[model samples]
Target: MSSAYPTAIPDPAEESAPTTRCRILAVAERSFREIGYQKTTVADIAKTLKMSPANVYRFFESKKAINEAVVERVTGEIEALIAGIADAPGRTAEARLREAVAALHRDTTGRWAGYPRIHEMIEAAMGESWEVCRQHVDRIGAVFERIVRDGVRTGEFEAADPAVAARCIQAAITRHTHPLLVSQTHPELEPSLVELVDFLLRSLRPAREPARG
Candidate 1:
């Protein structure tokens, strides 16, 4: 529902260089949120900023560039959240992994409900092989890999290749984390998030011993 400017868009300050780009990105994000990206024009963003469309172009070459920047910003937020969950201290890797998966589901579903256009843009970016989209996937994959690595260190999971496990987990959760895939699900036809996470956790757990007589 709120603006989703790229994390690289630096914080604004008095007479700072990043301030102009920051301002432009802020207005453009808001405009996209208000009017879907497909319907929003660079001129619309310029007028909202009280500037000319030509000036908007000075910072961004075209609408496609602006859209990619916005996508990067949104996925940047998601990537940061994934990193935060992976780094959360004092929790077993299982707890951290569950939280990580849940966080992505919540973010993707929330945005899909409130800012459908952003979700649509992300889907298109994926289809088109956008660089930002690749970066987003790589960053998210890294977080999953971190959690898997931690699990192995803690003896909670038995995996020779954390990278493979990480990729598997990421792919397994696509229905919950991908907007387009999620859109196809029927609430009545699917398991709850808790159930799905429980299944994934089982895969990560070490084989249990038989109970002693």
Candidate 2:
């Protein structure tokens, strides 16, 4: 697949700078998906795009830069998805939290699980493009925090610290959400997604008061 949204090959004279850049990233991301990022070279991307390597570098200084853009595009999408769920009106915080966690697991498994080599793309982002990965994590964490704060406000959850609780929620779902671990680990080795989400929700609920005399 050339891209999730493929465009026709660009004519240098006709395509705007942003259009050319998007074209390069589209080809580069396809190559990374099919061939793995370590082996997908600038020349290969340029060749596939019918452009010179020099032209490819006009937008991205290095393969790493192109990969960063691709990872950002992917993460930006999931972030928006989670953010929308976090802010959806007329939903309880617990409901939103469950949906958001399930969405992350579903998105991760759908995109990376059972795809043997695609982990290379995320591995590259985690190693060489860590700021991009870290920013994505932080954004996701912020969404969790928003939900936690809502739950606290509504007296549905008790947390001495919502930020800490949010990070805990993110950490708790790593097995379900982290691409590398999800791709590599067998399903039986870990708790089921529903089981895990239910456990997390239980941890977030308010502590019950003991019966008085």
Candidate 3:
């Protein structure tokens, strides 16, 4: 599937650049949150880091690069959480799927309410040819695909194509995960989270035998 955002750029930072990049991203995230991204500049981020603009530029080329790094940071956090849930011990696939979807919803909502400015950055990112957003989508989709394949292997789900099922599941929950959609969604107006999971699980269940007279 074509992506709505751009791909991530490979960075080969020197030994100290990693630490410096992290510092720059941290300050840029806060500035974006408190002051908004369009208002934040390379000079502002550098000043917050107590470094010269040239120093910050050494780690990040420009203002756009800094914002992309911050957005990628957010996507990386989501990927980590989804990976952890996918590999959680001793849970049925159904249970794990439910938990993963719930976590996605909560994280999306949290971004909108807790860090509206960061959420705004996400919205802007998705609307453009941002590779980080594309990579984010692919990474998270892979987690769902893995969980669905597990379900099929364990006889918890019956599917001709686990990848297709995974896509459908994510498509079903887009309202809960997409930054722009989540902000406009009212929780009460939608089916309860558990109810949604139950319906999706039913779609994966094996067909029941017909009763005969």
Candidate 4:
């Protein structure tokens, strides 16, 4: 299998300021993937980029800042993917919601199953960079809200408040989607992903009309 880390860290000396910043993050993400973020020092990233630690500091004030930037990039990619599924053409709202949740499960397992140490970076972000984490959560919830509102408008779903229902759905699926839980839990021990999504979808369906006497 191809290594997830880059083959070569870019030489940031000849790069522009923004390019240098992006390169530093690239190297730092690789280092974090190889070794846990706690063990990845600013000096290590600097050495990889063939730049002085002081130069790395010019772009990021400290290790925490670098971790925040990396987390933002990773979470941003995830948000973009989920957003795409939410707005996909020619799909019903129900289909979009099901696919979006499935995508989250697949993403969590596929991305972190190979690199267990990834949890360390995520945990660090949660503990130290909560604002970054919160923004990601909020963005994801917004996507869910959009799909729920679409469903309600089409009479495919019944929700008094789409925003609240969207959050409920997000909370309900946390076990299937959370990295720590997905990594640690035995697959056979939990409800299947399809079953869970089906159950949530049932809850959102509009109530049936009263039967004739």
Candidate 5:
């Protein structure tokens, strides 16, 4: 018996740019979020924006181009948050980490909730946009790495691989971002931004010897 093979898809990144690229990108992001990346088409965006499909092509050659722009926009917000966290003033490395995590969650869930569909698209795009997603992840990890290294250097945290420690810290912080997780585990424990920072600080503290009897 013969088996059928999947067809190879075209890469959207290879297309040429158009004169009204910015306008097309803006409309594309809005449309994609309102409907969804899969359901959205160049024609749909063009119709919503009162433009011809051909005109949309004059801006973005294909739907993939718009998707790339959407991903970039979301990633840009995350990068900005990471940058702000790195620059924030804190008494210790752990304090900085906590503040950074809280800030990231608030910004991501509060201001950018519309991008959840875009995020889902990026994950589904796997082969098409995996590199873009990876780059953003690396950028976030770098911020955490810097905080971890600073903590270790100042005796604020125990010695460990900064890169690995950064990943762990990021994972812990991300887990609290789920609405279900926060609601179920911390419903009554509404932590102020500073309180969240304190929790991270305590977690990063070095172990102490048992008290003598």
Candidate 6:
């Protein structure tokens, strides 16, 4: 997998050049959410930001660049949350993994829903940005891999392959984040986010000793 940075941060000097760029980003994010990616345009963002299209273009070269920025921003938030859960003290690997999954679901499905369009756009792009998305997922997978490795080393888990287990954990994590997958199969149950977390943790745990039957 590529190790390059996904989004380049503008110069520090540009940071202090008023809040026009920041305002443009905020407005663009909202416009994307309300109108979907296909309908959202630079003009829409500029009008929302109370700036001319040319001025908006001054900050971002194209709508694609802005979309990349939006996706990068949201992906960073998701990565930070996963990292926090992984680093939390007093939690076993199993518990930490569950917490990480739950936190991801809550953040993605609740507070960060506005950025779903950003993800949709990235998926449709399926080029350079797709690599960025993969790297983002791999970052989360690295956390899961560490948890699995720690579990096996400490005898908390009996998995023979930490990498395989990590991939499974990543699958579970993705399932929780993708509402369509959850809704399509079990429309009736509609499991709470916490319930899904418990389900995933239980699946990852080693089997109990066989009954004496």
lDDT of each: 0.78, 0.87, 0.80, 0.87, 0.66, 0.70
- What tens digits encode model 4's per-residue C-alpha lDDT throughout 115-209? 76888888888999999999999999999999999999989889999999999999999998876677766668777888888888877878794
How does model 1 fare in lDDT? 0.78
User: Per-residue lDDT for 67-119 in model 3, tens only?
Assistant: 78888888899889989999998898888899999999898787765555665
Q: For model 3, which pairs clash?
A: 5-130, 6-129, 6-130, 6-131, 7-131
Full ranking by lDDT: 4, 2, 3, 1, 6, 5
- State in Å the error of residue 189, model 1: 0.9
Query: Candidate 6, residues 147-197: lDDT per residue as tens digits?
Result: 888777776776768888887867855655753233233437576656665
Candidate 5 achieves a global lDDT of 0.66
lDDT of 6 at 122: 48
Superposition TM-score, candidate 1 onto the true structure: 0.83
Q: Which ten residues in a row have the lowest lDDT in candidate 6?
A: 178-187
lDDT of 1 at 135: 84
When superposed on Cα atoms, how far off is each prediction in RMSD?
5.7, 5.4, 7.4, 6.5, 10.2, 6.0
Number of the candidate with higher lDDT, 1 or 5: 1
**What's the TM-score of every candidate structure?**
0.83, 0.88, 0.84, 0.87, 0.71, 0.77
Q: Model 3: residues >4 Å from true position, as ranges?
A: 1-16, 114-116, 127-129, 209-213
For candidate 3, the TM-score is: 0.84
Model 6: how far is 134 from its true place, Å? 1.2
Q: Could you tell me the lDDT of residue 205 within candidate 6?
A: 60
lDDT of 1 by residue, 1-213 (tens): 124334565455323435566788788777766676678888888888898898788788887787777778789999999899899889988888899998999898876655656655665566654788888888899999998999898898878799999999998888898866654557798888888777777777787843222
Q: Give the runs in model 1 whose Cα sits over 4 Å from its true position.
A: 1-17, 127-129, 182-185, 210-213
At residue 188, give the lDDT of candidate 2: 70
Candidate 6 regions exceeding 4 Å error are: 1-18, 111-122, 125-128, 179-213
